[model samples]
Target chain A: MTSTETTPFREAPIQPGDLLLSIENLHACVEENEILRGVSLQIRAGEIHALMGRNGSGKSTLSKVVAGHPAYTVTAGSIHYRGQDLLGLAPEDRARSGVFLGFQYPVEIPGVSNLEFLRVSCNARRQHRGQEELDTFAFEDHVRETMAIVQMDPAFLERSVNEGFSGGEKKRNEVLQMALLEPLVAILDETDSGLDIDALRIVANGVKKLALPTTATLLITHYQRLLDAITPDFVHVMAAGRILRTGDKDLAMALEQRGYDWIEEADGSDTLQP
Target chain B: MSNVTQSRPRLWLETLLQVLAQWSGGGAAGQPAGARDWGLPTRRSEAWRFTDLRCLTQLDPTRLHTGTAAPHWPEAFRQAPSGQVSPRRLSLQLDGRGHWLSPQGEPPPWPHGLMPLPTGDIAPGQVLRTVIPSGTLLPLGAQLNGVTPGPSLGLQVSGPDPVHLDLAIQAEHAQAWLAPHVLLVLQPGARLCLNWHVAATAQAAVLPMVEARLGLGAQLEEATMAWGCPGAAFLGGSFIHQSPRSVYRRTNATWGWGLSRDEPFVRQSQGQAETHLHGLAVARGQSLLDTHSTVYFDGPAGRLRQRHQALADDRGHSVFNGRVVVPRVAQQTDASQLSRNLLLSTKARIDTKPQLEIVADDVQCTHGATVSCLQADELFYLQSRGIGRDQASRLLQRGFCEEILQRLPQSALLWPSLQSLLETPVPDQP
Candidate 1:
C-alpha cells in the first residue's frame, strides 16, 4: 500500500467550536474486567474538560480507550474522531490523526536517545500533516526551541529516554511531547500527579499554551489544584465507571471544598444506579 | 557402561585429532608434542554441559586443514577504494590461514610500532601453558586451538602515539577450519586500540587463540565482532595478563554461528590495574553462543567492571559464565559483574552465571544477572507515539545492544557486519 493510502492524516485543520471527539456509552475493559461502563463524554475544539474521580472510577480508562491503548478492549462503544470511526484504527494511526495521551507513568526506555525519539515522533506527526520531515540538524534546533515550553534542560536530550528522570521531569517530558505533536485532542492523564508546585505550574502553563482555539484538551486529574491552574470549561464527576455529574468550573471548587464523598452524597441516586 | 561411553572421544573429536596430527607435521618446528592428543571436552564435563558440539561431527575431516589463500578479498572488505588508506586507522586481513592479507589480497608490510614479535619468543605451548598448567585440561575451544598450532602473528606494540589497528579474520570456503594464533605485548606507557572481525562461511570453523601481556601504566582496548554464517562454528578466546598501573578494556559481540564459544582469561598479575569487560551475544535460528570469562586479581588494590548482554530468539541458546576471583592477598579489590539477557521466543534460552569468589575481607564485590523479555510498557509507549509495532521492537532491540556496541572503538563502524548486526530482523513466533 502507498504511504498516503495507509496513513490516517488530518484532512483539514480543526476550527474552534467543532466537535473533535465524541465518546458514546463507552464500555471498555482491561482483560475480562470492565472499567469504563456506559460512560459518555464529548470534547469540542477550543474547550478544556477535566475528568475528576476517585480511584477506580474509570477516568483513566476512558482516556486510554479514546487513545487506543492496546491493553484496553472497547467492549461496546463507538468513538468518532473528526467524524471518522476511530475504533478501527491502530494506536499509531490514532496518534497520527492528532490524538495524544500523556501517560500517568511515562515508561523509561534505556539506551534510546530522548532526542531521537522526539525527532522520530515529531516527524511522524509532521508527515501526517503533509509537512516536510525535519532532518537531524533541523530537528535539533526545532526540538531545542520546543524544549523551552516546559523549561527542559538540553542535557535531558542527550540521555536515554526518561531512563533516570525524576517524576517531575517525566511529566515535563510528556508535556514537551504534547507541544511537539500538536494534537487536536490532547488527553493529559494525571500530568499533575507527581509534580511539585513549581513543576505543576510549568506543566499547566505548557498545556495552556498548547490549548489553541483549533485544538481541545482533556485534563484527567484527581485534585482541584490542576483545575485551578488550567480552568477547565467543564468539570466531570465520575462514579462507578460513569459520569454522574458534569458542570462548569464551579463543580470542581465545590468538590475541592467538600471531598469526593460529597459528590456521592449529593447525587446518591446516580451514584447508586448500576 | 556410562563411564566407558564418556571416556571414549566422539567420532568428530577423533577425526579432528587425526587431521591435526597430520597438519602439525608441516607446522612450526617447535610445536608442542602432546598437543596433538588433546581432544575436546565432552558434555560430561561440567563446563561443557550446556554446550552442544554435534554440529562439528558434520564437517569433513579432509577439508579441515588450513592455508588455502583466498583468490581475492571478501566482498565486505573490498568496498574501500584501492590504494587509499585512512590516516586515522590501519587495517589488516587474516585469510583464515595464518598469513595476513593486505587490502589488495597480497601480503602487506607491518605498520610502524606494530611489528611481529621475533620467532625466538614463541614457546612450544605458550598460550596453553600460560593459562593452564601442564597435564591440566583446557577448555574445548582453547583445546582445539592448542592442538593444531599453525602460523601465528606475535606483535610488540610500543610507541608514544596510540595505535588504532583493525584486523579482519575471514574464512571463505566450506569445511575450512582456521586455527590462527596471535600474541601482543604492550610496552610500558603505550596505548593500543585493536578491533578484530572474525567471519566464516559454510561449515568453516575458526579457532583463534590470542595472548597479550600489558606492561606497567600501559593501556589496551580490544573490540571484537565474531559474526559467522550458519553451519559455521567459532571456538576461540584471548588470554591477557595485566601488570600494575595498567588498564585493559574489551568489548566483544558474537552472533550467527551454529556454535560459538569464547573462553577468555584475564589475570591482574600484580593488581593495581583496571579492567573493563563488556560483551553482547545475539543468538537466533538454532545457534548457540557461549562466553566463559575469568578475571583474577593476584595482588592488592585492583579494580574490575564487567557487563554482558544477550538476545536469544528461535531455538537459540545464549550462555554466559563470568568468574571474578579476589583472593586473600588481593586486598582492597573492587569488582562488579552484571549480566542482562533478553529472550524473545518461547523456545529460546538464556543461562547466565556470575561467580564472584572474594576472600579478601576488605574488598568490595558485586554481581547480578537478569533475564527478561521486551517490556510491554516500553513498547506501548513508543507505539502511542505513532511508531509501528515492528519499528518499536527494532528500536528496543537496538537499544538493548547499543549499550555494549557503543563502547566499541570508532573504527568498528567501518565494518559492514556491525550495521547488519544491528539491523537484524526481529524473530517471528512459530
Candidate 2:
C-alpha cells in the first residue's frame, strides 16, 4: 500500500504542439517577502509533470501565483494558459477557464454544506461555458458519483465543507472537487501530505481517471512515493523558487537518495538564465 | 403584574410622566418608580443605549394626549387576510383590544383544560412580570391601550397534556400608538408550543409584550418574529418565570424595522430550570434593530444557552447585548452566551456586548461577542471555484445566518418572505 509500481502514466510523446500553460521568468511576492523568483516552466496537453522541491522552496507559492491568487502579487512575470494572459484574469475567471489548484490546506467553511457549495460552484462553471446549470437533484447524483472516485463517505456531503474533517478527508474532498470541476490544467499541491496509504491511492487514482488526453497535470510533492502511484512523464527539481533540473521519473528516485545538495551544487556551477 | 413601577419623581415632560405613572399603576411595590420619574429614554439610558426614542416620538408626537384609538382594521387585514397580508400559517389574528381570531375567522382546537375568552375575562398574569417589569415602554404602551375601551383576548391553560397555539399581532395605522399584551400560564407537567408573528405596516409606534409563567415541571417552546419597514417603530419584549424542573425555549427574529428592539428577561425561581434563547436580526436600508436579553439564575442547578446574531447591510445599524446573572444560591449553574455579527457594508454598523455577572462560587458561565466582516480569503475560496464575487459573498452570508435559521420552527422557516431575507445581496465589505 506504500507505493505502486512505476507504470509511466504518460508514455506517449508529450503534445508540445498544444501548449496549455507556460510560465516565463515569473516573480511573485506576498506582503513584504518575495516568494517565487524567476520561475519558468511549460506544460503541453496530455502531459504530467512532477515538481519535487524541499520545504519553503516556493512550490506552493508558485501554484497559488499561477492560479491568480490576489494575495500573491506577480511583480514581474507572465503566465499564459491556453495562449491567453492568465495573470490578467480574475481568480474566478481562471477557474472558469479550466485551471484548478488543489490547496495544501483547504479552508473550513462552517455552516455551508458540501453538496450545496459544490453544486453552486459547478453551476457557475457550467454557466461560464455556455451550458445549462444542473439542478440540486441532478447535481447530487453527479457529486455522489464523483465522491466515490475519491472514496469519500456519503455522510461527509451533509456536513459543512472541510469543517471538522480529518486532514486526510480534506485532501480527498479536494480531489473530489477537482474531479467534479474537470479542469483542463490541474495542479495538485502537496496532495500527498497528511494522507494514509488508502487515501493516497484513492486520490492518485482519481486524478489519473479525471485527466484527459487534452488536459495536463502538475503533481507537486516533496517525496517520490506519490510519483510511484502516479508516474509523471517528467520530473523537475526546484530550489530558491526556480526549477534547477529536469529529467525522467528516475530523477525523482535519484533526488530521494542523493538529497538536494547535488542539485544546489549543479545549479551554482551554471550561469542560470530566466 | 409586577412590571417596573419605582419612580423618583424627577421633573420631566408631562407626556413621559403621564405615560409612566399611569402604566406603573401609581408605583407598585419594589417596582422602580424611576419608571415614572424617569423621562423618556435617551442614549443615556443603559437599556435604551442603542435605540433612539426620538424616532418613536417622531412617529406620533401627540401620543400622550391621543391615547389608544379604536381598532380600525386596515383593508389588507379585512380581506381574506391571506399570508401575504399576514402570511404565517396556522395563525390567530389580534384585531383589537381583548380580541383574537384565526385568519379563517375561527379559533384553534385548544387541548383538554385550556379555554379562550375575551381580553376582559383574562386578568393579565404576573409570571413574566420580572422579565419586562412594569416600568419599561412595554408597560407604558399596554397601559395606554387599557385607557381605550377595546377588545382583547386571553387563553388559559391548566391541563398536563401538550397545548399548541399559532397567533399573529397586526398594528393599526401610523398615527395611533399601539400596545398589545398577552399572558400564558402553564400548569405543572403541562407542555405548550406557542408561535407568534408580529407585523406593523403603517407609520405607527408599537410596544408588544408576552408574559408567561411555567409551573413546576412544565415545558414551553415559543418562537416570535417582528418585521417592519421604514414607516414603523416596534419595541418587543418577552418575560418568563420558570419554576424548578421547568424548561423554557424562545427564538426571536426581527427584520427591516425603522427602529426596533427585542428584549427578553427570564428568572429561575427554585433552580433546576433550563432556558434556551436564540435571536436573529436582519436589517437593511436605514433600519435600526437591537436585542438585549438578560437571564438570571436564582436557585441551584440551573442551565442556560443563549445566542444572538445580526446581519446588517446598506446604512443599517444593529446592536446586541446579552447578560447572564448567577446569584450565590445558584450553585452548579451552567450558562453560555455568544453574539455573532456580520457588517456587510461600509455604512453598516454592529455593536455587540456579552455581560456575565456571576456571584456563585461553583458555576460555569462563558460569554463572548464577535463582530466581523467576511474574510477576503473566504471570499477568494468561493470565487476560486468559478462563483462571482457577489454570488460568493451571498453564499457566505447565507451560511453565516444558517446557524440560527436552521434551528427555528418549521412554520417560521417556511414563512413566504423569509427566503428573501437571506437572498438580499450584501454590499462588499470596505
Candidate 3:
C-alpha cells in the first residue's frame, strides 16, 4: 500500500486466488530458435517478481511473451491475465486491459512530442474507464506532475518522443509513462541495463511510488543492485530457456555472489512450493 | 470557332491562338478581348500528363453557373490572431469566367503604393488573375489566365519605395466555375505577405492562374491552402519571375478535392535570388492530387530549398514532380529538394519524382524522396500507453505535417482552426 511495502520482507512462494497473472508451461520463440521453453510462473496482485538469467536464458523472452510482442510465437502456453486469455488479444488490447511493458530498448518515435503522446495515452485510459478526456490545459498539468516522479525535464515534453534522448532520459520516459498509465501489471524488461547509478535510483523510486496493493510488477534484470533498490517478493533464476529456481530476494544475491552455474546444476525445477 | 468541339489539345491551341488574337487587339466589334478561356488538360500535353482532366469532359461548360450573387465568406478565412504585424485583407470573389461580382460594400483602402490595374469592376482583390507574359515563346498556362473573362484588375506593389502588403483569397460560393487571374509586381525593397484560401464548394470548378514579378531586393512570403467539398475540383498554375537579390518563400498545402492539380514555376533570371518552398498535399476518398513545380536558375549564385510532402488514404492518389535546373551560366548555384510521402492504406498510392538537372560544373544540387508507412512498432509504442491506434495515427500525421507548417510566419499562424482540422478523422480508405 505504501512505497516501502517491501518492508518486513517475507519469503513466500506464489499463492492461488487473487491471481493477477498465471503463465502455465509457456513456450515461445523467434524464427526457429526457441527462447522460452516450458516456463511457468504466477504473480499475485501485490507482488514484485524479479526474473534473472544468463545471456539467451529467455528472461526477456518471457517479458515479451507476456506483452504479446508480435515477433515471438507461442508454440504451446496459456497466459491468463485478470481471468481472460491474454494471448488471444492484440498487443493494444492487452495494453488497454491494464498491461504495460517498459521495453529493454525503448523505441524512438520522431515527430510525436512526449507531452502529446502522454496526453493521448492517459486520455485513452481514462476514456476506457468511462471518464471524460482532459483538454490540453488539464492534460498539461497532469503530465507535468507525473514527469516530476522521474525527474524528467519539462523541456523533454516538447522534444520528440525518445528522439535524440540519452539512455537515462529514455528510461525516465518509460517510468514517466508507467506513472501516467498506472497499469495493473508493469513489466520492466531490462530497464536498468543502460541506466547509470542516478537514473537507476530515480527509476526504481518511481516504480516503488507507482506500485499499489492491486498492481503487480515483473522486473527482468541481471543485476542484484536493481533488486537492492526496489526489493522484489520473489526472485527466479532462469537458465536454458526455463526458470531453474525460485526463491526470496536472497536468490538474486546468491546468483550475483556466485553465478547461474549453481542454479543450472540444481536441475529439475519447480522446487519452490506455495 | 465557337461552335466547334475539338480535341482537348487542339482546344488548348485554339485557346492560345485566341489569346494571341486578343493581345493583338483583333477581337470582333462589341466583344471583350480579355475573355478567359479555360482549356481542359489532357494526357497528350506535358503539363497535364500526370493529372487527367477527362473527368471535366462530362461537365458541360455552357451550363456553368455564372451567378452574379456573392457568397458569405466562412469564418475559416477570418481567423487571424491579433497583434503581430497586422495587415488589411482583400475580400474578392470571382465567377468561373474570371469576373468579379458587383460592389459588395466599400472596399478596404488600398495600402500605399499598391495601384489597381484598370478593370471594368470597381471591387478590390476579386480579380485574382496575374497577367501571363506574352513575351516568351516558352510553354505557358498563360492561356488559363487569358481565358477567364472578368473585369480585369491587377494589384501591383512597386518598389521605388517600400510597402507592406497582405492579400488573402477565399471562396465559398456553390456551383460556380472560377477561372481568375491574379498578378503581383514588387519593386526593389518591397515586402508582401499573400495568403490564398481556395475552396470550391459542391460541384464547382476553380482554376486560378497567378503571375508575380519581383525586382531586386524585393521579398515575398506566401501561404496557401486549397480545399474543397465533394465533387468540387480545382486546377491552376502559378508562375514567379524574380530579378537579382529578390527573395521568395512560399508554404502551400492541399487538404484536397475530387480532382486537384497545382503547377508552380519559378525562374531566377538574375543572379543572387533565393527561393524556398514547402508543400503538403493530402488526398483522401477517391481524390486525385498532383503538384508539379520547377525552379530554374538563369544566372549564377542562386540558392533554392524545396520540400514537398504527400499523404493519401483509401482510394486516394497523390503525385509530386519537382525539378531544379542549373544551367552553364548559373554557376555556383545551390539547390536541394526532398519529397516525403505517407500512405495509410493498401489502396492509397503516391507517385513522387524529385529531379535535379545541373549543367554547370560549379553548381551543387541534390534531391531525394521517401515513401513510408507508420511503423508498427511506433504504433504499438503509442498504444501501449493506452492511446488508440486512430488517435495515435492522427497525432503522428499532425506531427508529420508540422514540419512544413512550422515554416509559416508566426504573424500568420492560424492555430485553433488548423488544430481542429488535424484532429478531425482522416479517411484512410475510400
Candidate 4:
C-alpha cells in the first residue's frame, strides 16, 4: 500500500539438493502491512551466508518469520527445513528441532536467572536430540565450559537474564545461547550490530568456531566488518523485501565501500522507502 | 429473594457478636456486643472496598471452632534430614488458642536474649490500640480480638546477641477461627529475627495482630508466610513503633486464602529510623487477597523502602494500598513505595494504589504502581529457547514471585506449601 512493490516474484524453481533450509517465494506481514513481499533463499549445510541490507529492508523480518515469531504472519510462503514443512511447527518446536534466531534486540527478562534460563533452554534442545537432561550441577559444569567461548564472566549467570547488561555484553549472551543450544541453522540477526572492535572480533571468532560442516549459519548484517572476521561463503543484497543480487564475499566489501545507496542505484529504482 | 439469602452476612454477624459476648462475659462490662460497634466491614469502608468478605460471611457460624488444638507441623518442620538441631534458630509453634509450643508439642523455654514480658506490663492489644489514631475505627480483626478471650504472648528481646526465632501458627481443624495477639518489645541495642509460618484449615479464620516496639539502636527483622484453605480467611495486622536509630524490616508472603487481608502500619516515632516492608500475594481461583500498608515518619530523617507484588490467576483478585506519610517535622525523609501486580487471565483482577502524602518540603518521596499481564516478549523469548508456552509462563510467574519470596525467612523459603503455591489450585490447598 505504501510502496510500488506488491506482486510476488519467484527467482527460480527449487532443484533437488541436500539443502538444510529452503525458502521459496515467501510473503509475510506484520499487522496489515506486508513487509516481505516475495523473497526466496536457499541454504545448504556447512555454508555461512551473509544477508546485507539497509534499514527497513526486511532482513530482520525474514529471520523472525523463519524462527516462527508469533507477531509476523506468513501470508504466502513455503519454508522447508530438512524436507519438512517448517511453517507447520510452533516456535518452541522449531527451536527444539535445532532452528535458532539470535535476536537483534534481545529481550531482557527480569528476575529470571541467566544460568537457569540457559540450562532449561539447553535441556529442551537436548531432550529433542535424544540426550539426557543435565541436572543443575552438571549443567553448571557444561555451561562454564561453554561460557569461555564467549568470554562471558560467571557473574552474569547469577544476574537476571540481560536485565542490566550493556550492549556488548548482551550480544555476547546471544552467542552464548547459540553455543549452548547448538542449533543446526543459526540465524545471527545483527549479532554484531552494537559490538565494539574487541567485542566484534570475539563474537565473530566465536561464530567461526561454532560453524561446522553439519550446520549452517545465516549472518544478517549491514556492514562487511563482521564478514572480515568470519568470511561468508555468499553475500546477498536484499532490497524492497527481496534479494536484489547474490554473490561472493566481494559483494559485501563493494557494498561496504560504496554504501547501500549503491545497490539501489544499480537496481535502478528507489524502492527501499520503508 | 429468600430471607435467608439476604440475611447470610447479617446472620453471621449476629452469631459472631453472640460468640464474642459469650467469650468476653459481656462486651465492656454489660454492654451488648452488637451495641459495641461490632460488625463486618462493608463496601462503605474504603479499605475493604475491593476485598469481598463473602468467603467469610458465608461460613456457618454455629460451628465456628474456638478451642485450642495441637498444631500438626508441616513436613518441613519435622526434624531436618540430618536430624540435628540448628543452634542459631529456635523454633516454636502456636496452637489454635495461641499457646507457644515446641515442635514436639511442649512449651519451650525462652532463649538467652529473649524472655516473656512480666505479668504487670502493657497488655498484648494495648500497644496496637495506641498505634491507631484516637477516633479512627479499629480494624475488624483487632476488634474481634479485643472481645475474644484468646491467649496472648508478649516477649521482651534484649541483650547484645541477635535472636532468631521461627514461629508456626496453624489452625488445624475445620471451622476453627483463631484470634491471637502478640506483643514484642526490643530494648536498646537488641536485635531479633522472627519468622512466622502460618496455615489454616477449611472454613476457618486466622486473625492475628502483632504489635512491636523497637528501641534506639535495635533491629527487628520479621517475615511471615500464610497459606489458607478454601472457605478460610486470614485477617492479619502488624503495628510497629520504631525509635530513632532503630531498624525494622517486615516481609510477608500470603496466598491460598479464600479472602485474605493484611494491614501493616509502622510509625518511626522520632524518625531517623529505617523501615523496609516487602509483601507478595499469589491469588488464584476465586480467592481474594488484599494488603493495606502505611508507614508514618513522625520526625526528621527517616528512611523507608517498601515493595508489594501480587499475582492473580483464574478469577482471583488482588488489591494493594500502600501509603507513606512524611509530615513537616519529618524533613529530609527518604521513602519509596512500589506496587507491582500481575493478572494471568482475562477474568483475574488486580488493584494497586501507592500513595505518598508528603507535607515536608525537603523530603524525597516516590511511589509507583503497575498492573499488567506477563510480558509477551519475555514469554516469547523463553519459548523461543524451546521451553513450552505453559512451562515458560510458569517460569516467568515463578521469576516474578522470586523477588519477594527470596526475602522470606530461611524456614519459610523451604516450605513445600510456599514452593507449590504457583503450581497447585489455591482453593483446594493450604
Identify the leading candidate in terms of lDDT: 4
True contacts kept of each: 0.59, 0.51, 0.48, 0.53
Task: Write the number of the candidate with greater DockQ, choosing between 1 and 4.
Answer: 1
Task: Estimate TM-scores for all models.
Answer: 0.89, 0.85, 0.81, 0.91
lDDT string for model 1 (A130-167, tens) is 77788889999999999999999989999899999999
Better of 1 and 3 by lDDT: 1
TM-score of chain B of 2: 0.80
Residue-level lDDT of model 3, residues A1-274, one tens digit each, is 0011111222233343368889999999899989888999998888899988888889888887887777889999899997889998766566666789998888887667777777777765555545566878998998898889999999999988899999999999999888887788899998898989999999999999987778899999989989999999899888888878888898889888998787788773556732
Candidates sorted by DockQ, descending order?
Answer: 1, 4, 3, 2
DockQ, computed on Cα atoms, for candidate 3 = 0.32
- Considering lDDT, which of the candidate structures 1 and 2 is the better prediction for this target? 1
Native-interface RMSD of candidate 1 = 6.1
Q: Give the TM-score of candidate 3.
A: 0.81
lDDT by residue (A1-274, candidate 2, tens digit) is 0111112222223354478899999999999899888988888888899988789999999998887777898889799987888987777778876889998989898867788888877866666655667877889888888788888998999988899999999999888888877788899999999988888888889888987778899999988879999889888888998888888788889898999899888883542221
What would the per-residue lDDT of candidate 3 be over residues B1-430, giving only the tens digit for each residue?
5537676555644544444344435643322343334344556776557676644443444445544334434443334232113344344445434444322433435655666754643232222222122443222334444544554546677644444433333445454656666777776777777665565556766666667788788888777766765577777676788888998998987765788777788888865899998988888878888888888898999999999988888888898989788889999998889999999889998989876788899977888999999877786676567565666678678777777777765434552335333647332110
For every candidate in turn, the CA RMSD to the true structure comes to 4.4, 7.7, 6.9, 6.1
Q: Give per-residue CA lDDT, model 2, range B1-430, as digits (tens).
A: 1224522222223444455444446522323334434345567767667776555666534353223332223334335343223222234566544356556555544445566644564366345455554644553333333333333345566666666566666654665555566677777887877777666667766676667778899988888767776777877767788999999999877886898877778889778999999988887898899888888888999999998889899989998888888889999999988888999899998988888888999998888888889978778787777766767778888888777777777766655556556766332211
User: Which numbered prediction scores highest in TM-score against the true structure?
Assistant: 4
How accurate locally is residue A271 in candidate 2, as Cα lDDT from 0 to 100? 25
List clashing residue pairs in candidate 1.
none
* Clash count (model 2, backbone only): 23
Candidates arranged by TM-score, highest first: 4, 1, 2, 3
lDDT, candidate 4, A50-82, per-residue tens: 998888999999999998888999999799997
